[model samples]
Target: MMKRFLILSALISLSIFSSDKIGRLPVYKIAVEAVPATEEGIVLRDFIKEQIQSTSRGTISLPLKESESGNWEFDKEGNPTLETVANIKRYTDTDKLVLISTEDGQAVISFVDVLHRKLEYRNSLPDSLSKTLVSDFLGFLDKKNIYLALSETGSGSNAQLKINSLKPTYVAGEPIRFEIESAEDNYVYVVLVPENQKGEPILLFPNQIQNDNFVRKGDRVTIPDKRISFKASSVPSKDRIRAFASREEWKEFQLRGKKEDSFYRLLPPAVTGTKTTARSMTVVPNTLTASIEQSPVMEWEYQILSR
Candidate 1:
């Protein structure tokens, strides 16, 4: 009887860990409202909707109508009223309600948390409706969520990876240094992804140069050591560094066809099997065959400004 109970407990733990490794994202019901009548308003609304869907990896639900309480109200200028904002904060079912309004050629975006009844994020554009403006807004949203999720998932994990840069920003032609640390003995893989490019992530470790991605438990590893350095991209853009650690060896499966150029691509099966869309330049552990039950992944973002 005791052996059966132990087996059942192990199975339950494996189920929970496997679900997370396979990219089961937390679902959120998001409400969006924008002054769709005007050109700028339409642009803001469409961009927000598309970006939310993409960044959330389709984990968000968009309802066509407002909540039953009907507390969401907008002024004649299409701005959210204080009472409306309060009502959205008071509501519990909705995850967030995004309100976008443009006035005097400037766009304002606000993210309200209905459960917490607090203003999550508020930003005003610099009186322009360019693609860069939209990209910046979307990047802000993606970065915020990505960091928050990573923090929550990484906390209290048996095996974890943390990445830090030598500097806050990098310039063209400069070599960048990264400090990596792991909480447990695991094989660590690091990949550097430049957001401006549409190619495979540059594998920083376990390559021809280093040939070693294994780290001892509670050990600190630095990439591009004193003798070597990672060169910055010529183009200026936001980039990200993802570190995936596992108790077992991980093998990356390459994809064919149009993604042929991407050497580090995850196999099609891994993409289709996962619940969330995989990010470019990051490895999904479920794509790899490992004997272990838990595989944890973490990521950090930085900027590369043009000189």
Candidate 2:
């Protein structure tokens, strides 16, 4: 009888862990309203409601509430606020509200922790009519691909392998997000190379014979179009790994956000001189030979923020 009980407990534990992992946290309560009442505004309000109700399930809890008036204002840091986000539990009663407003070709979303009086995430979207906006937002919480340069010891083999990049698109003032999976058996090293010069790949090894402290187990890597997520346990430190992108350029990244249509979308990076699209890239084989460096993996989904 004890053995059976133990077996059941193990099974339950495994099942819980195996469930669809919700990549985003619930917002608890969300108050949405369109700017400039019109035929379009009413339709938009209903669309936003449906999207919020469906997409933010495991990510955020957006309870429905009614408010008379609200406005968008920022603090000294120029961060926007969502009038009364603190008491979201009682969001329905108070006149104070958390506001999300949309205008001609732009949309601004903000949230405030009214109780703590702190600001959370806020973003602006360009003119788009995509319905799967929430999916894009939720997708942002998922892991992204990042590019890494690795070099071999004596083989003179230099190559770049695409990894994952971070989400929310780092702003110029924001710090680089480089969280790794674990740190027990690995280290991350980074050498910034010149922009115009073609350089060798960075090295990352498993065994700790090399004095490479640049790459720690939990250290993160970012790419132009993706994010490479790693835990301390899975990091490789022996291989010489380096990056060549500028600190300023590193700030730009693909954004994920909720759409008025109720689906999520991937906002591609701003178009520049170079036309880089993840969709055009071909898929790389998963399992590769250790001797030969592996190719970068590409995803063929919605890189566009709108429909």
Candidate 3:
């Protein structure tokens, strides 16, 4: 039996692609998780405030909307907690957040991406702030583009992953085959979203039958390696496909219920951050060089039509 999400080539395709009930991706928002009340924290907060509103100061536009979240909640490790990070997502219209606090008497700042679920670790005030502050502050909204970012790693990864042999289009009842080419070691998952775009997408790989998602680098994995088959849907629709590969083993948060041939249903990523824990990519402040690691995320969209 296949795990779920992935359909067996022999099983006829059905319907299931939808982005969000809103009929489109939702716009993201930003917020200030909290500013420290300590003398250093206050100073840092003032500096940030003066910078972000400079663009609107004398202009006809509105001031930077700032919410002073009461206080900071630290975990046992002394770093900000995930629940605190989630607070911004839960309480505000912002998709991103800037947190200011004093760490060991030094003023530090962290950039939290609520949508992507990452925190750019703290950096010293002197080394981080500058004239471009406002632009950078508001620019968080466009900071990450999944389609483009996942496609280009800024640098080709050691475990380069490729999706190939998929036809640009497919018709109902037709056999569909594709290849997931990658380096010696990497984990991967693929999702199919039907044209209707109404609910969760279908997981296409790592099914019960093919439960092992791990493959060596430079490996070319073919769907339906077995004699059984997978055919296009008898019902016509334009569907989308998303695949993710990384050195780290990862899985999307799935909903609980009856399984379709043991296939799992994934939560919508845009709003609920279903795969937010997985790397969508986060960057630290300047004066910090990023070490090479994590493929971040990957996706592909294909047109499957039925006549």
How close is every model to the real structure, measured as TM-score?
Answer: 0.42, 0.30, 0.40
Per-residue CA lDDT of candidate 1, range 163-275, in tens? 65546566666676777888788887665544533333455565444557789877887785555445665566566565668676654432222322212322323243331
lDDT by residue (tens digit), candidate 3, 258-285: 4435344333232233323322212221
**Quick one: best TM-score, which candidate?**
1
Local distance difference test, candidate 3: 0.45
Residue pairs in steric clash, candidate 1?
89-117
Q: How many residue pairs clash in each candidate?
A: 1, 70, 32
Alpha-carbon runs more than 4 Å astray in model 2: 1-42, 56-68, 76-98, 129-136, 139-307
* Per-candidate local distance difference test: 0.51, 0.29, 0.45
lDDT of 2 at 243: 23
Every candidate's CA RMSD: 15.7, 19.1, 13.9
Candidate that beats the other on lDDT, 1 or 2, i.e. the better one: 1
Which residue runs of candidate 3 sit more than 4 Å off their true CA positions? 1-159, 225-229, 251-262, 267-295
